[model samples]
Target: MGFHTFDVDRADALEDPGRYRFCSREELVAALDIGDGAVVADIGSGTGFYTNEIAPFAGRVYAVDVQSEMHELHRKKGAPENVEFVAAEASAMPFDDDELDVAFSTMTYHEFASDASLEELARVVQPGGRVVTLDWSANGTGDDGPPVDERFALADCVDAFESAGFRTVDATGRKETFVHTARR
Candidate 1:
């Protein structure tokens, strides 16, 4: 993560259901288009909130986060049986090349939106695998999420993914959030 990471002290905010106002579990699942036996990873998973939402639909779900405290919080929250904890950064994960069927992030795209990180995603996800990202948009009013100055616009995300060798499937820049789905 390049910008300020989520503070572990305010982790309770991550668990609040109201946080779903900007991005919901349903929208994320739809964007992912998970297969019956898909192996997926939830990058920057804070407390297995969205990770738990996707685990029942996927064969395996890796909860990947750079902070051990976040994983610990997830552990305390009791994740699903199929959820695996991965304490690693987005740009440098432990997974083998072309191993993942899909990878996604919720409100975390801005933190790891560098060339190295997007390229790492392109490297890990197999061909035809999808990469879904939902985050605070630069187009949004500075009311609910991070400042617009730190967020990325829809075109920025599309360019980054395309540059990293993924093909855009769909993209929507909404009021406060932007969702993008791309295929490797």
Candidate 2:
């Protein structure tokens, strides 16, 4: 795992619509490039913000998070018909090998990023499946999101995923964030 988990007390901030300026739903959905029936997992799926957005396009979506309270919060907020909540850490998920068609994380990669997590993702995602990550970049100024010192640069993400046997598909370092898609 990475430096720190998000504080549940401030989780309401996660639902802010203004966040779309950094990562719009259209951008994320396009980045995922999933079929309508894809089995997906939203790692660190906080309040199900992005999970709800992707649920309509997926056959099943596992909202994975380490915090049980986060699941409860999402449950109270309501989930789509195809959504299921799983309280688990990123490094140790319960899916069978190659079970997921795709898995993606938004803004939470800094919290669950590790060699073990990347390897686990490689194990769970089917061959040719994708893992998409968008998170605050170390290259950004310390103006928003996590402090710069706590964030990882795009190169670090690419190196870690490549080391875990994933092939990089797309990687772009934007102004305040980075998005990387890797194939398992």
Candidate 3:
């Protein structure tokens, strides 16, 4: 199992521009390498912040969140035309086998990182499809995000993806965050 769910009441913080300090749109899009008409999913896509940044680059972008309230907030914030909101858990998405060309998650990975979730991602993303994950690192100082005890290191992400049949393309551990790119 993963960590606890983010309290929906504090969802506003998810949209702050200062959040770019951890993960910027340019780096995220570059990490995705999304092509025209490619199918993508944003796992734990809280209020469609990063989802909006990615929608323009892909054919279909699934704004996936387990909480219905999160989806509602994204709708209120004006989700893009091609963006479809899916109220589902990261370990149990509704997409078909090998349906997604790419998938990504921001700081919310700690709440959904699990063996089952990684297996689910392997099942949904096509072979060679990229999965980019950026989240709070276990090695970080307890400055921002959840407590350091709840986060995962870049190596932890590499192990999880590898166990689920993904090839680790890159793994970087920053001061307060970690980014792991894997290919299914």
Candidate 4:
């Protein structure tokens, strides 16, 4: 299936929400290593899952998503004062150059139509800022499950980030899910 065919509504209502769940929100926040006054952007932030979780740790969070319904649901869920939702295409963020201190996306990289999204990611993050990604592993063992072809391996994500001018920092082996950290 083509990337544009992805149905955010149907996908959000899947029987197994755990498949899309983050491993440990606190761990992710720690890995980000942001100070209390840093600005973070959560790309493909669905229903404020990571947005709300990371808000308490950062100065502000930009919850960017292509789906307005998801953004509305995120707002209804009672986001923190530090969170802001912006309807954004994955390939083009709305922020100015180097405006963000950290960038995060959970279970979202594979949903992008092409490398345009990575370019956008690199564009908004400042030099030496961190970019963290959590996604379904390509090992075909996730409980929430991703479309076979849409799933990406750790290496694939690392290469994409590197090509976009990010330097890989660390990656969790081939677990059902993996976390990758890179720096611009």
Q: TM-score winner between 2 and 4, please give it.
A: 2
Q: Which portions of model 4 miss their true places by more than 4 Å?
A: 1-22
Better of 1 and 2 by lDDT: 2
- Please report the TM-score between candidate 3 and the true structure: 0.98
Tell me the spans in candidate 3 whose CA falls farther than 4 Å from its real position: none
User: Once model 3 is optimally superposed onto the true structure by TM-score, how far is the C-alpha of residue 168 displaced, in angstroms?
Assistant: 0.7
Candidate 3 lDDT by residue in tens digits, 88-107: 98889999999999999999
lDDT (0-100) at residue 12 of candidate 1? 88
Candidate 4 lDDT by residue in tens digits, 1-184: 2144335566454223454345577678877999769999988887877788799899989998888888777777689998988888878888999999999877777776357888887888999999998877787565665766668888888888999999999987545677899999
**lDDT of candidate 2 over 1-184, digit per residue (tens):** 2847889999999899998998999999999998979999999999999999999999999999999999999999999999999998899999999999999999999998898899899999999999999999999996999989889999999999999999999999999999999999
Off by over 4 Å in 2: 1-3
Per-prediction backbone clash count = 0, 0, 0, 1
| Deviation from native of the Cα of residue 81 in model 1, angstroms | 0.7
Point out the higher-scoring one by lDDT: 3 or 4: 3
